[model samples]
Target: MLRVFRHYIPGITFVVIALDVSIVSATASLAGALGSWPGGGALWPKAACLVAVVLLCLYLADLYRLERHGRRELSARLLSALLSAAVITAAIGYAVPAFRFGRLAFGQTFLLLTVALGAWRSVWVTLDPGQRLRKRVLVLGVGPDAAQIVALRATGAQPYDVLGFLDDAPEAPERVPNGCELLGKSRDLLSLVDELRPDLVLVALADMRRSFP
Candidate 1:
């Protein structure tokens, strides 16, 4: 779950705040249509306050925390936050008697809020900055450990600059399973990486002794 939250939670808060702004704006615009309660002239102020309340509630729920959660758990948390926001909004509107927000506006706000939040998440996934920052790297092995780094780069998880591989055993494949070059033997790593000046140097040699071997 930490993985999921670390990757998504801040951006989720950003999206939620955006959606809340839209919902509150919509509610304020249609306050009269919804049946304005007693102290109704200050619609915008009340709407702004409602938005603030939603944000506070989200924070209190720990919805904006950067803790990770499984996909199912994250979804449940999101759903609960949404429901809680709606309930709180309704309850406050009732108690204030001055904030006359209506049912049609409520429906519109909630529906639009969901769409806005989902869109923000989609945008975040599409525009992941790690993908944009292409860093070069050279792995020091052709074995299982090195292979995992290659897989991670290919999957767009870790931004790496894999210039190629440096295998000591000549008979060991000349190319990595993921197709980076077998630049040379393990002894040549420092020189190769120095020349490459890659953003990172991942020593994925299965045997730690082979790092300098």
Candidate 2:
């Protein structure tokens, strides 16, 4: 998770934002050059400003909060953000003519940014679930203690991927929720760690007094 402005954003979402900003800025510069806007050397600053405005619009529209909105909702939000950014850009251009790229360049840049950002986000959504960037967690017990972690997962409160439980008690019933894998005894910790490669191992043993190797 990436924290910005006290808000926790998913890592993938942050990557998307970075990509969008880069693409938007590039598109703006390209549009300016194609339209033959004056001050060719100084055009980059204008392009950067345009991208900043668009990103601010997107932030206001909650585009950065990936978990809160579904694809359809996100698309609608993006459209609204683009429209808002365009309006704000037009207003700024009207008030400060020196900062304005011509109408042709502005239109081209807006259209390109909309398409680029939308396509990028579409691909991100499609691939995000299969990405291994999310932390994988291994629970070290299968008793009531471990059940709490499973409960948290069931409630969707813990975002980490669970790699399931481990226990050494041969007679202990499966106390973890159904569908969660019980990946053998505690004695197999090293081998399991090697095979699973979990980002975190949570010790929730019922008998903490027992010496664990």
Candidate 3:
């Protein structure tokens, strides 16, 4: 359930915006019908602004979130938020004398917005599932730089397919043999490891390191 909610954030956001738009338009049209709205020309801009306000209000209230609340609790939160938004909308309509929107418009808009939002949430979840595979890789270097590459890969979500480490230095030899093979001389680098087909090739050598000798 937690995973499900995380995957549906985008859908929820889209729904919220759509709902706000529908509500504003309906409210403005109704106000116009009632002959209570401001000068005729200002209806659209005012409606647009009203939609913006509603969106802002939702944001402040944190209504359109996707946290993992239990089923019943989650439903309660949503219901409360919707009711709160409706009351706020009515208050705004009544207080601003210029904004004389109709109640019928508000009711219809709310229902339409509800249906649209729910449908969108369903569609978005179907399309985008979060889990994905990550390939593990082994770095074949024995220097400071090689260690850094290994570290960075570990932090990210994509799991690595690290086979092991391989040391190339000839003199000192490998100190901590981490199970990686010391595949032959560097000169045969291309031909020897062809089967590995690594997704990433990190050359972690200093200028002093000699070519395959």
Predicted structure with the largest lDDT when compared to the true one: 2
Q: Is candidate 2 or candidate 3 better by TM-score?
A: 2
In candidate 3, what are the lDDT values of residues 28-86, reduced to their tens digit? 56655755424424566556655766676556655554332333443455456556667
Candidate 1 accuracy as TM-score: 0.43
**Which candidate do you rate higher for lDDT, 1 or 3?**
1
Scored by lDDT, model 1 comes in at 0.60
lDDT of each: 0.60, 0.73, 0.51
Ten-residue stretch with the least lDDT total in model 2: 1-10
Candidate 3: pairs in clash: 30-102, 31-100, 31-101, 135-161, 136-160, 136-161, 136-162, 137-161, 137-162
lDDT of 1 at 119: 54
Clashes of each: 8, 0, 9
Order the candidate numbers by TM-score, best to worst. Answer: 2, 1, 3
lDDT preference between candidates 1 and 2, better one: 2
Q: What is the lDDT of candidate 2?
A: 0.73
Tens digits of lDDT, candidate 2, 134-176: 5578888766766567667535644676777778777555576
Residue 148, candidate 2: C-alpha displacement in angstroms: 5.9
RMSD of 2: 11.0
| After superposition, candidate 2 runs with Cα above 4 Å error | 2-9, 36-41, 129-213
